[model samples]
Target chain A: MTEREALGRRRRVVAAVVASLLVLGPLAWFWWSSLVPANASVMDMGYPDTGGGPAAASGHGHEPEDGPRVSVATLTGPSGGVPDVELTLTADAGPIEVGGRTVAGYTLNGTSPGPTIEAVVGDLVQVTLVNRSVPDGTTLHWHGVDVPNAEDGVAGVTQDAVPEGGSHVYRFVVEYAGTYWYHSHQVSHAQVRGGLFGALVVRPAAPQEGVEAVAAVHTYGAVPTVNGSTGDLRVDAAAGDRVRVRVVNTGSGVLRAWVPGSGYRLLALDGRDLHDPGRVAEQAVLIGGGGRADLEVTVPDDGSVRVRLGSQSVIVGPADDAPDGDDPRSTLDLLTYGTPTDVGFDPRAVDRRFDYAIGRRPGFVAGRPGLQWTINGHTYPDVPMFVVSEGDVVRMILRNSSGQGHPMHLHGHHLLVLSRDGAPSTGSPWWTDSLELAAGESYEVAFVADNPGVWMDHCHNLPHAQQGLVAHLAYTGVDTPYVLGGDLDNTPE
Target chain B: MKTAYRVLAYLVATGVFVQAGAIAYAWFATLNDLDGGAVIDSDWEGNLGHAMHGIVGTMVIPLLVIALLIVSFFAKFPGAVRYALIILGLLVLQIVLAFVAFGAPVVGALHGANALAILGVSITAAQRVPRSTTTTDASAPANAVA
Candidate 1:
């Protein structure tokens, strides 16, 4: 070819190359900036701050030194003395009977719903957990109790999982009188679903005279059961006897509990008593997953009062008087059920506010293909780090648009439900560690940052959490020495 | 011979554009997947992005094969042969860069940058094809090495 022609062709090629780079350079920069911020690394997303010690406050864990004096190592329980009430719980994995169905599961003390340990307020409750045959090991996490960081029982975080034939003692004072439960924290997705949980009811110092029954509802092999019984759990009650049914939902979904033949009052929720609970009839109380509700009902004159849990019944009187057919009653709305009372702190003066919108999108997680649950439109590891200083009154708005219900459970602290959707709560103070969110529902909950630790706030649906529906509520100065996905295989969900 | 060269160039250029489109789609899918904060069911989007990337990346193998066949058989089109070889070399480089990206994600930027160059060069090569042998002879030497 001619020299001039070759030069012109080369010039055109150079011009095209320059033009392409000019266009693509800016686009690449924009994409990089959007996906990875300039100052933040992928490590900032969910990796534990490995710097260690109290001086390693990098604004991620624990507030600055000038902030509130929130000690992370301090225990919330009583300072001294051996545990007043001691109990032993042995975890075993084998075929167990649940609601008449023999299924492979892990159980506590040879039973799915382990023995209910009763104690009075002001007593120190100590439970020695012995891992008998659980291959992956086990650690008991008091689901709603705000114990010290060391006693939280998150495997790899607070402490290592108790291997087979090993034991761990959890000692904490019963400061509050209400219904609570404990479950395995190691590989909890499979352990909790396979049983390995039990009820813990702490009564008031001056106990009231009544017929008390604990109805621990769970789904075994897909069969709904109340107190491990599939059918009616009969509790003999004389006429005029006041019955208090502590309904604890241990399943991964919301459960509806109601008295079919009598009116009842909701006394407490999540271990906290409601103020001036008025009587209500013909409505079922909805309890979120991992939540508890205490209902009071007086036995009828002639027949029985049946407290229906899910599809099963807890007959307070004679089973012959139990009503048949479906309960056509409407569900009760707890947001406006009882008389309003003081919540102590004003929710109006919130220090920090955050909106956590739960959504779902098709994507990949660690190379696996599926639809993933998301918080605020981002998947796990990329989820929000809700930072707060100690003593700060924080308000969080949870919105679910995922077309599915999520029982969101927050660790280390309980929150007061302020409103549902947009309506303000007018009932007695409703506190919850696990809040249920229906599809297209929004709830606003507020809580003080009293517990200074890196807490996990995730869906109670363990499988959903395994798929990535998890986030962290991080205090400024508290850093976790734990590493997820390490050699321990710690699946905290 | 001129028509055969034209067809092969057009196919290579089309492959380049298709690969570019696939990469762009994958990039956006990855963005959507990453933006899905704490969602449990959002993994499919990321998997689809990787699938598109794999499908498009594998497409280059067949495209390079066709270009090689054109150069081997159509000895008259020397210019088209050179362009085909350059494209084949770039495809190999792209594959290497992609593997390197797994270890050092920062290299992904270079992988993306190289993709634009491949697209541009393929298009330029396609545009250089002569409409007829009379025009081709005027622009190039006779009996050119393929």
Candidate 2:
């Protein structure tokens, strides 16, 4: 062939390649990536851990305490909601500083994350919510609760957003208990993101021994947190003491709470007990907003070791693709991610079977297009509440609906995973405060109606909660019309 | 004699587009039907591979062989095709490595590279139609050589 002809052919090849990228290239990508199992790396999403590399915070351990102890209490809005007690919430102003300050925010009780409410399951919660900012009106959503239709906190839907200087008394009989949370259902991404949130732990009737703690999970932009804090955590526990730590995922973040050096046995997730308590040496407890995981840890002979709380990194495998959700291996996280959990409990009987799916969808992450994460066929519902009776032995089959794996967690109730991805995890020495639900993977989680209240089940990644990947598992009062054996969900029989 | 392969390349390109488009269309349609915004927000990249898992997981393995056949016709032993296949081959490798790495940054980087590989395959497949009487390598030198 002539040199000119060869050059012309080369140009054509170049143009073809360009055009193909415009057309066939995307097509090839579609087929190779779309048509085949995702060889795409979970790490390809390129999310930077806010607390430096997760491992930088990995090896911290708690030093033994002599006698000094810090008294940590739940705060609140005028009416208890996501905050321990509900107070007048100030709407957005300039960049409001929360936690240590510097970032823009919305304030509740003059602080970000509103308040932390600590109450027993059966206590009568009397909260007077006062909204002082934003003329558009503000409403408090008792996230993870089964309030009446009129009382259900939705801006325009259930009730009007509390007006500037407007106050509403939120009185709810805390029936179902566990670590549940609340936030403004309206202007969710806006207000909640602005710092109008907190932890709500409804103390269970039969509280376990050792230490009882609350860790609220949420996201600060791309960051995930527990009680709005990352890095080190310490709760006073005597040696060999069975400590039960409660977490309320209020900020729409996933939480991984584990005592790194401590042997944390997962007691419950989503306020439900596991069929078999799976002991995790390096455990990952996934808790979304309104999701809770109870861990029973025997404070080691030593005082404490640092427990890491962060998103799980996915493991890439041969065939270049991760194990699909259906494949048991694919559901596993690549990172040695973990959070300590509660001890095991005896089961009454296998009540029923239900499944849930978690995943991401197209354009889930901004830079990353055509990506998404979801649970079941849906992610978390952006609605104010999910209605149900209290005290029911619920079995949720958690399936990771999207490509990303999520650490599924629940609020207000700790649950035990009866199975992972539909197979029996019960026999796998099951006990977990949180467990990993890989992409397209599912797990069968079971628990009793011991804790009666509204609960949340969602991915434990803090940001996931803010984006509305949070679901509510409501437990109405036993006297309610929707009783489980009768209505199939009320707290007590 | 080699011209026959040119026609085949054109056919293959056309086929890839059709299949990819069909898959994309299905994905778009399914996404549209659900309240994706309420839950997943708005991202489609993660879904494509997952939605295609059934076809990709089951069919792609077999197609790898066919893709190999197509590659064989275009270039000499393992040079061009091997380059493109490297990214494709990373799928299985990633899963295994993740198990070892515990989902750390090393595994993360490999995943990022695989995504780049997917992008490379798409570009190469589209550009193939115009080249003739030239060694058609599916991957760039960096991709191919590595």
Candidate 3:
């Protein structure tokens, strides 16, 4: 080859080498960076633990020194003659049998929907939670009961998780009477789905004479169960008996409850009774995840009353009798159900109004690729902190455009449904801690900020919550001493 | 050899515009991502933009190298060969600058700024190529330009 030709070939070779390096260099770096562990703490990711202190040795952070302490002594009922109901619950994690299927799950008192604790209004309910074998710690969050801030059971926030072999006591007076539940807040996404939950019923002062049953609905390893049993749950009742079925949706999906054999009244919702609830036939009630619905059914003269929750049936009569026929699509709309009553607080006098628009975006979550859940277009750790002062009436416009339903839940307060899809609610006072939102749906809810604490307002669909569908409802003058994604592996979702 | 050179020039030129389009789309997607204030699951656009930018950005390297190799063989298009080599060098520098930009915002801005220069040089080199063999024959002798 000539000298010029050799020089020309060398130039081409050099160009190729440079080009190859240009392409491969960045790719190699990206692969290397992805493999490296994320050294930053949750607080470093723009969410600082303003109320900072060293995390407790038990893997749970302590509340700020100035924050209110919830002790067993302070949770006592008023002196003299108030009936006190006390119980002990142990949380265990292992392979457990449910609905004929042995699945791995966390359990309370050796059962999935732990024992139901029943009490009357004004009764002091004291429950000691003992963490026996649950690794990663556990704390019982009273789902709907408005307990003291310290007894709220949010690990690292309200209280540190009760370490394994350690115990904590939750005491409060049953002020309002209705169906509520308790579940773990530590690693809640795994623990709650694994079955660390139970139902709590507070009866009214004047107890009505009737046959009552708590239908705690949960999904154990993809199987729908009612009161820990799959298929039909039978309760024998005479023709004239008034049967109250309290349906609790513990899973992260909407559950439709309907009585196929008898007409039923929508008695209560989210632990609050409806005003003059009227009887309705051939309609189902949709209960949001982490929400509850109480239905009263009158047994037929002979045949069984089949109350179906999702695919599981609760037969409230003879076992062999056939279920009555009705179109399941004829679902009851609770927004206009029952007589309308004064909600006491004027929603128009809102102190703070915020728009919570839920959307989905394809992005990196903790350096991983997937479609992530967003609140107001921002993913978790970058989500909005809906700030309010104590006693402020806050109104939130929740719009869902994410192509799926999100059962939005707020801790520490129950929001009253003002309107849905721009239509004003004309029914009884509708209150909820978990409000279900369908895709393309909008809802306006208002709540008085009486409870002062840094509370989580997030999607109750625990998986979505983990995918960044979470935000904080921070009260002015209140801060959380806890940090997320630390050594404790405190996954509040 | 001249025909191969022309084809590679055209391909590299097309790739330059594609890279430009990808970068433009990425910029628009980033804007959309920023506007996603509080909306969940809106990161798809941003992620798509990043992927497109990376893919097109990496693709430019080999396209430029092939154009350089083919143009070098033509011998008459010495200016085209020089431009191709310059673009390849810029691309390498741009990749390094982009990684550096992760830790320094100012460097990132420079990385973005250098991309336009690379595009300009790529297009210039593609324009210098003869549209057909007839044009190449009608032009000056191979040793004249060199």
Candidate 4:
């Protein structure tokens, strides 16, 4: 080979090597840049150097401009025994965005899942529901409301589904407090799944200070509103202030939860007080349908805490809180503007604990997704029936192995949950019916085997409950004739 | 004279490997950004990790393959041809062994066989090549008089 040719070849090789190096340098940079997780905890991402670069024209990303806003903070109400509540529901039944797609829904005030109803124990609630959607109207059934006999929403029994554009007013007293929800009486699966149900947080008669709650709306049809998982709302307090967090699973799936970075101790569940509240420290509270727990959690050090929402989080921080009764400040406080709250979870304080499992049973004969609910892998029966013995410290472990959610209901009795999603509901404790248990979720509740006779534990979606997803929690009785249901004529014998 | 070029070529190939390693590392770190579960940490960490996977997965592996090729090619010195082919054969065997050994009860046996083959042939090739030892025969003249 000629010397010139050799020299040229060498030069070409050198060029290729340099080119490769140049290419690798940028590729390395690109690789390094992308390696960081999208959600890497930026809490410690280098502190902003506040005054560096000549700030460019600010409007970079078309960030949504915050407009007229409102916050949900403190709510004041006249003190009394509020066992029942009533409201006129004008359901604007129509198509709405759920899971990003528009689908039919039973919305109150043009919103799916209705409005959030906050009430305390000993209050009477009267609701008049006007269904303006489906060809066949609907009846209002408080999924987990502690109400009277006549007001029970059973189609053809309690009252025929108020015809379309028809109205029915339900009046009942709030017997307990906790995380309860409401939905249609019959054919509710289709409607509630389409957006008819909502959160009903019943607080204690003497509410705990700095305790707050938010009804997290879960819908596959709708993207999300506020709380990503347990719903959205925040509370702020100075260090040592007891912070209560009540989680209500309103979707058709078992909801798993934890405080993420925050810590707290659980106190009670299902409205049933604890034999010893200290057990909540190490106890994992799992609330079945119609259950509630009071958690006692101290605020963390000044900074921000992102409440883990399954796979996401809602940022909670130590910021200024609204003075005594500033409405807007209260609302903004719900969005996490609160002062330092020095509170730590006392693992020894939890007095009660139970085991709940979330599992699914596949039928070899069937191909479709089968019934998904909780309570020891058993689906609730259509005609509610149960067998229970007295003197049993009823520790009910609700394991939802199914793909859908079931809000188990205990007719006459209430149980208390010490923790939720393996985390305790710090300070906020109340009672009610219809605790929403999401799919693949588990909850633990304990109650005295006190309420005799057969009680109902089933999905709140009346249709799902009606379709054999109901169970009977019956207490044994040999002294007299064991009768079930408040009115025999309305319920099947 | 030609050896100088070969030596330089080997250095270039080695550089490619280091660069590839850096690329692979980048991909490993960004996995979470891909909206993929925390292949590392599953939290609110968003989906950028996956979006950058293309750069790491695509750009790095090819460069390493080229480096390996260069390394294999230069493995052509005195006994390099025979030694390289044997080593190459063992490499292929190890790859096959790795596949067969996966989830198999005979994994330990397969691994032992792979190590033996690589070591036996490599030693044989070394024996055939000129050694730097004092008793070396090939590098010195068989007959000093000639």
Candidate 5:
């Protein structure tokens, strides 16, 4: 071969090597950087976001050794006392009937939408969880109850999941009376969707006169159900009787609920009563994922009333001929629905301000490349750790530019809605634990950092949370003995 | 290496076709659902067609393009490197347009147009590979440009 031809061959080979390197180099780096350690503390996972408050000396690392340390395991409810309400729930995997069709799913106490647990205000509630045939372990989270950190039931963060045939106990005091729920938090994206959940209702000290019902809405596969049944939940009521229905959305999306025949009042939200809520008619109420809405309706004298819940319905009065409702075009704006009242705490007197900006960007998560959700432009484990001190009034601005809607949920605290899109909240000092934010929507909320522990603040759309749309609100000087992906194999999303 | 480059380019072109078909199916299915009283809103989880489009567009085609770029260096065909680079550039632009289209759906028109551009460039790149050329030596007629 000629020297000139040989040189051309050599140069081509060199160029090939360079091109391969250029193509593979960044990919390898991103894959390596996206890896999360099998066992790592929630405290050490992400960067510290001070939220303009006092900066931690450790910068989201371990607490300063010189200062006193508090472990999350020590944060518990009152102990060594007789439980006011006690029950045991067993989780098992089997083929259950959803909408009269059998589906492979998980169940609690031999039924999906397991038995409702009722309590009065200021009563101590205790529950024992027993995992039976579930391959993946299970832990029950007291949704919107604001239990102590140890009783929060988040696997790998608050405690380890209960393995098969193993048992765990959770005890907390019910401080307020309204609608709430419980669901498995381990492998929650799948377990909750498969129906390992139930309703929790707390009543007032005085006996209520009206008929009460619970409509725990869930979707098993593509079948929407209420209280584990496919058809409308029927209530036997006479004419001129008053009925209160508690609606809980356990699915991973927004739920639109409306009444077609009779007007209803949105009595409560997220287990809190609205102040002087007026009557609502011809408008649907949007309940975000993991949210609750209490509606009060007066049975019509002539016909039955139908409450449309997403894809399911609840019929009151005579069940034989209930009026089916249409999905309303207009939604009730909670921001201006009720009369305003003092919310007890001043939102303007804030100690910390944080920005939780949700966006989507192309990146690698756990070595998988796609368009992943970002919290403040950073993905999981590298996302923000909102640091706060106990008793501080924290104000946060949540912005969603991700071209999708997210029902943002914060554990252990109920955020008071101050405003949305710069418009002040004129209704009943709206409070929520799950706040829905659509694309290009922004909300300002405030809450007191009275619950001191490591808490998860994530999207209630479980799949999105698994896609790195998760962050945490951690208190200073507080650490946890548990870790994610540890020997327990706890996967908490 | 020349054969590998050609196969990858053809695969990318086929991927564009799959994307077009999948998105079309997704919209048609969505329309049928809406007609049957299914509310399309934030709560709507897309149908299977959208999932297919996403997987192919994001993972399958991009990987093929990268492989083609690597093979182009050693293929030794005239204009092979230039064609591969153009295809890669168009694919990158296609992805960016897709993301932007979400916030402003009007930009979806551009995304649709760019997909055609990618399909065209990918086919052009594959055609640049000389037909039935097995010889890799310097004496082969395929290396005349070199």
Candidate 6:
């Protein structure tokens, strides 16, 4: 062979080697950086975002110079008290009947929506979760209940997941009367979607005269259902009777509820009653994922009133059949719906302010490549740790530039909506645990840091949370004993 | 190396056709569902066709294009690197257009057009490999001595 040919061959080999390195180098780095340690503490996982607060805050525990440290395990409710409401729920992995099609899902006591646990305000509720056959383990999270930190039931954050053949007890007092829910927090994204949830209703202390029904909506596979049934929820009521329907959105997206043939009043949101809510005929209430709306309607003397919940409906009146109505073109604006009243504390007197700006970009999360959700422009394990102190009035601005909507849920506390899109709330103060933010929409909300614990603030679309659209509302001096992705495989999505 | 480049390039071209077919099926299925009283709200996570389109567009085709680029360097074909680079650039633009289409749906037209550009360039890259392979086969005896 000629010398020139040999030189050309050598150069080609070198070029190929260099090109391969150029292609493979960054991919290797991304995969390596995305690897999360099996047993890692949430305290050390991400960077601390102090929300412009003092770095050496007085009560913070991790600083080592603080007064005292409180482990998350010891933040329990009264342990040795007689419980007013007690129930044992057995969680098993099995088939759930959705529209007569048996789909593989988890169940409690052999049923999907389980049993509705009802209690009165000021009553102590004790729930024992017995894991019978679930392979990955499970824990029950009180959706809207402001239980103690130990009773919050977040696996890997507040407590360990109950393994198969094991049991865990959760005890807490029912402080407020509202519509709430309980679902497994371990592998929550998959387990909650697969029917491991039930409704929790707490009635007020005063005696009320009305017909009440809890309509917990969930989607089993492709079929949307209300109270584990595929068809409309039929409530037999006499003419001129008032039916109060509590609609709880347990699924992954926003649900619209409207009553046709009769005017309805949105009595409550999340779990708190609104102040002087007026009647509306054509407007529909938008319930974010993991949110609740209580609707009251007085049945007309003519026929049935159908409470349309998107595809599903709640039929209330004397007749069996109610014509389905088209969905309302406009949603009921909560910002201007009811009369304003005192919400106890002032929202302008804020202690610490935080900005949660959500966006989306192509990136790697846990070693997988896709268009991933981001919190404050950072992905999972690199997200913000929103630090706060007990008794502090915390104001947060939630902005969604993520090209889609997100139902943001903050555990252990409820936020009062102060403003939306820079417009102050002109109606009743909106109290909610799950606030839905559409693309390019922003909201300013405030809440008191009454419940002290490590809490999850994240998108309630379970799959989105699993994709790392999560942050934490951590109180000062609170630390958890458990770690994520540990020996027990605690995946608290 | 020549064969690997050709196979990867053709696979990328085939992926464009699959993406088009899957997106078409997704819209048609959505229309059928809407007719059957299904509400297409924020809760709707699309049908199986949409899932196929997402997986192929994001994961499958991008990997194929990267492999084709690496193989082009060692394939010993004229303009092989240039064609691979052009296809890669088009694929990157295609993804950007897809994301932009989410907020402004009119950009979807550009996304569709870019997919055709990727298909044409990748096919051109694959077609060029065979002619170079024929030339190499004829000169195989001289290279064997080296």
Clashing pairs in 5: none
TM-score of 1: 0.69
Q: What is the TM-score of chain A alone in each candidate?
A: 0.86, 0.53, 0.85, 0.53, 0.97, 0.96
Best-matching candidate per DockQ: 5
Fnat for model 2 comes to 0.00
For every candidate, C-alpha RMSD to the true structure in Å: 11.9, 18.8, 12.8, 23.7, 3.0, 3.6
Clashes of each: 37, 183, 20, 119, 0, 0
lDDT string for model 1 (B24-127, tens) is 77767656744853122211223454566665575444445344434423434446557766776776677667655644678888888887767776666666
Error of 6 at B112 (Å): 2.7
- Stretches off by above 4 angstroms in model 4 are A1-86, A98-101, A222-240, A273-296, A318-408, A415-455, A459-467, A471-493, B1-146
Instruction: Answer with 1 or 3, whichever has the higher DockQ.
Output: 1
User: Least lDDT summed over 10 consecutive residues: which range in candidate 6 chain A?
Assistant: A55-64
Q: What is the lDDT of residue A199 in candidate 6?
A: 93
Which of candidates 2 and 6 is the stronger one according to DockQ?
A: 6
Q: How many clashes in candidate 1?
A: 37
Tens-digit lDDT string for candidate 1 (A1-493): 7998787556644653554465447545533433423233222564332212132343453334554443433543555687879899999999988645588998888888888888899889888899999998889988877776667887755666788999988887777889998888888878887888999988899966878899998776455678777767788888888888898998877788877756889998898898889998888888888889999888888778888886777888644556644564687787887878888888888788888899876444543433457788876656777777778788999999886778899888889999998999998888988888887899999998887776778888776776778777777665555555455555566
**Candidate 6 lDDT (Cα, 0 to 1):** 0.87
| lDDT, residue A472, candidate 6 | 86
Best by lDDT: 5
Return whichever of 4 and 6 wins on TM-score.
Answer: 6
lDDT of 3 by residue, A105-134 (tens): 988888888999998998888888999999
lDDT of 4 by residue, B1-146 (tens): 12432333343334334434554565665553345322222111123443233233223323433343333333323433334445545644644454334335487477446655555554454444333324343422221111
Fraction of true A-B contacts recovered by candidate 1:
0.00
